[model samples]
Target: MIYQQFQRSPMQTRISGPRAWLAMAISLSLICLSLFLLPFVLLFGAITLGCLVLFSRVYMARQIAKLNQAQANAHQHDHTTEEPHSHVYNSVNIVRESNAKETHRMRQQGRTFEHKEDEH
Candidate 1:
């Protein structure tokens, strides 16, 4: 509906004198230069991308080695006999404690409101 009432102004189509010639010449020169340098630009881009990929691979290898060494050290220093399920139980207890604290605070602030749906 908004677009149906909208009106656009006419575009200018007339250009004369030296300004028009200058604009044409500049545009043509830019087009020619881009065409001439396209191949060189592509070649440089490929070389740079290859170098970046190689560098990333080497960097990732170094990081993986460091991680492996750290894991080995951690294993050597770990002497606990606790089972993994103990951690889950501990996390659940922590969450319960946090929720209790939040509920207590909310009650103290008199904001303990419950929403109920109306039934016909």
Candidate 2:
């Protein structure tokens, strides 16, 4: 197998040598060019982002304005049909009373005690 491989071709290697060199040269040149243009690329990217943000903000503001205008128009049209305003009054009253009483009756061997508590 080794001998068969060795017998195949020096011609293919000779042709591939220039092709590989050309490919390497092209790759290196592109890498250098991109490095040189990096700052410009970043500046344009920032400008694009700023424009997008500005456009979005303006669009949102216009949308909000339209919504507010629509609401105002609807409110105006509904004003006549809407119910009249009504006022409500609420009142609360609280009363509290407390009483404590105790009585002791009995004599001699023991005493009897009575206690009472009431609230209203």
Candidate 3:
């Protein structure tokens, strides 16, 4: 039962700091054995880490923005069917009256949608 509780190490945890630096140090020492290699190793590692951090930050920011937009859309959807739709709240549902306005706008724009069946 005690042995059953133990699991193998995760792949994500495998690519860690000390181990990664050890691997890098070995590779760096093999390529260049000078004492000057330490500064380069540390600098290169820092730059690599900074780039990964920045990339993840940008990706997370976009994801959060998309989530916030979806939340706003949901909130707008909640107010769609209520009376005085635009003038009162500017919510999106706008049952009969808003549809008519949208239709009028579409006619003015001269744009239409057509759905096609996929051959696959």
Candidate topping TM-score: 2
| lDDT against true structure, model 1 | 0.76
Q: Give the best candidate by lDDT.
A: 3
Candidates' C-alpha lDDT:
0.76, 0.72, 0.77
| lDDT string, candidate 3, 1-120, tens digits | 766435655655677789898998899887776576889989999999999999999999999999999999986986785476345435343444456787668766996767777743
Q: TM-scores, in order shown?
A: 0.50, 0.52, 0.40
- The residue-level lDDT of candidate 1 at 75 comes to 60
The parts of candidate 2 lying over 4 Å away from their true place are 1-16, 83-120
Ranking by TM-score: 2, 1, 3
Over 4 Å off, model 3: 1-34, 82-120
lDDT of 2 by residue, 1-120 (tens): 779879869777765777788998999999999999999999999999999999999999999999999999986876756667742222211212132121111222454546656633
Write candidate 1's Cα lDDT for 1-120 as tens digits: 667434643332356578888998999999999999999999999999999999999999999999999988776655355565655344334443357878667656876456667743
lDDT of model 3, residue 89: 35
